[model samples]
Target: MEETILVLDKIKKSFDGVSVLNGIDLEAKRGEFITLLGSSGCGKTTTLRIIAGLESPDSGRVLLSGADVTDTEPNHRNVNTVFQNYALFPHMNVETNIAYSLKLKKKKAPEIKKTVAEALALVQLEGYGKRMPSELSGGQRQRVAIARAVVNEPEVLLLDEPLGALDLKLRRQMQLELKRLQQTLGITFIYITHDQEEALNMSDRIAVMRGGVFEQLGSPAEIYELPRTAYVASFVGSANILTGRCAGGGDTVAVDFPGGTGSALRRDWQGREGDSVTLAVRSENVQLLSSDDSRGIPAAVTETRFAGGMLRISSKLEDGTEVVISRYGIGTDLVSGDAIRIDWAAENAVIVLPDSEVAHE
Candidate 1:
């Protein structure tokens, strides 16, 4: 088992008399990559700040490598942060920027030069050390920032949406680079980002935050395949949330949605008959058939569009609930106002408990 390197015990914080981080706990394993994923105002940044010693929690202790660092100064903690902005000193060239931390520690000049060279090489910026920040591209600047942070050899690295400033293509490219850097360094990375794709692509585990608390915390696959709440189902990916009630229960539960009935695999919850439930099915899981086919719920194709090599079909149920289905390949013969039937395998649909039901349990 991996050793626990960082622990946040019941950490709570607030600003301006408004609660930001409602008591939350997280355990990060050594050399693990964990992401705090949520939208703005979700307290992800506040959590990162607390861990970095940039902000103190109103209550709870922060333990780093089994040592209580709740009151430790930012510079005293063995952690480093890279922000959305590169935060590189414009006046300093790449090598100088990366060597600044080593210089502060009063390392021998020879050691600092060697370490800075290694850091630059790790970031694939070997000969660019002499180049100023202004001369580099956005991606190169971000790489330089990462090199600077990793030069400290901190136990844990905190990244706050480091790719947010880059364009889409660059952002995707940096995601791969960041993951490679983390695995190569064998350093624990506590990253923060609101992009779902970024979180899913990069994190070993994700803590989905909302209203200052975790909506769900698990592996990317677990969070995507087995979302615990409707919000998670919707936020993590493209899920069609269908309102329904448990018509019957067993290995498979029958749910009656508006104008149709569907079956979903039974999960951890032992729901009773007639209990209100929500069904979450991914767009890819939904299949569209001709309306003449009687095997599924009837819907009308509201819109169809081609994007990212996938054909996205939007339809509305008889009761006016919008359902979206996605299929690979560009262009579909189906057009707007065409009649269609939507269906999915029983195992593909997930039954989600209502928020109140989940909260009461």
Candidate 2:
């Protein structure tokens, strides 16, 4: 059985009379890497702070390894945080920075030295202990910060966009590094980030937060392939959302869109005929067919752009509904203003709630 390492029960908070976290409940398994993903002011950072005991919740309980730590002070809790700025001391060398926590505990000099060396090795910076912060690159500085946090051997590591300052390539590299470190060290990590790709690539499970609450929570594949709401589908990746109405029923559902009527495999959706529904198809899932193709809906290509590994084609249906499709390659024979047809398989079309329903739910 997987052990529950952390639990947040009905965590709620308010600041200046405005509710921020509205009853957030979550459980993280031992050694799991969980990400709280959302835009700014989504309460992801607030939730992390609450867990770290940096801020007390207005009403809730935080349990770490089954011990209630909601009222505990930040330093008393068995957790460490890695900030986005890599908060290293300019005057201290890497070795001294990593050993600061141990020194504060009055640990012996030899013991602190040994532990710092081990921590440095864990982050692959074994021989750079004597280097000053200014001498290290951004990625190296981040590693030192991780070394410092892990040196304390906390039960949970809370990372607040630690890679936010790095360039895109370095950020990608650190994402993989953090994932590997979590696995190798077998530590529970509660990562906070607004970057969807980082959460998708690194987390064992993701909690999509919005308006101070979790909109959806699940594995990356689950959230990507079967989003529970339109917000999630649109937030996680590129989706071509289309408004439609249910036209047929049974094993499959026929939906009438602005472009045309299409069928989709119905999977326990309890919608009826003439009911408003939305269809979400990933841009990559849409196939561009020839203008003469009888099975496709007629559309006029409005624009095309080469986006490195893929070609993005934008089109407008007869009813003026815009649809975008992505094809893997450098270029497409079709160009702007050309009459084309677009179609997708029934399995690729997902019936979603209308935007209004999504908002209220």
Query: Which stretches in model 2 have alpha-carbon errors above 4 Å?
Result: 318-320, 359-361
**Per-residue alpha-carbon lDDT of candidate 1 for residues 322-352, written as tens digits (9 for 90 to 100):** 9999999886888889988888898999877
Expressed as tens digits, the lDDT of each residue in 1-361 for candidate 2 is: 1899899999999899988899899999989999999988989999999999999999989999999999999989999999878889999999999999999899999999899989998899989999999999999999999999999999899999899889999999889889999999899999999999999999999998987778789999988887777777788866887767889778888887665677777886898899877777899999888888877678899999988588999999887878999988885788789998888888998776555774322
User: How high is the lDDT of residue 300 in model 1?
Assistant: 93
**Which clashing pairs does model 2 show?**
none
The TM-score of candidate 2 is 0.92
Give the 10-residue window scoring lowest on summed lDDT in candidate 1. Answer: 352-361
Model 1: lDDT of residue 289: 85
Total clashing pairs for each candidate:
0, 0
C-alpha lDDT score of every prediction, in listed order = 0.90, 0.88
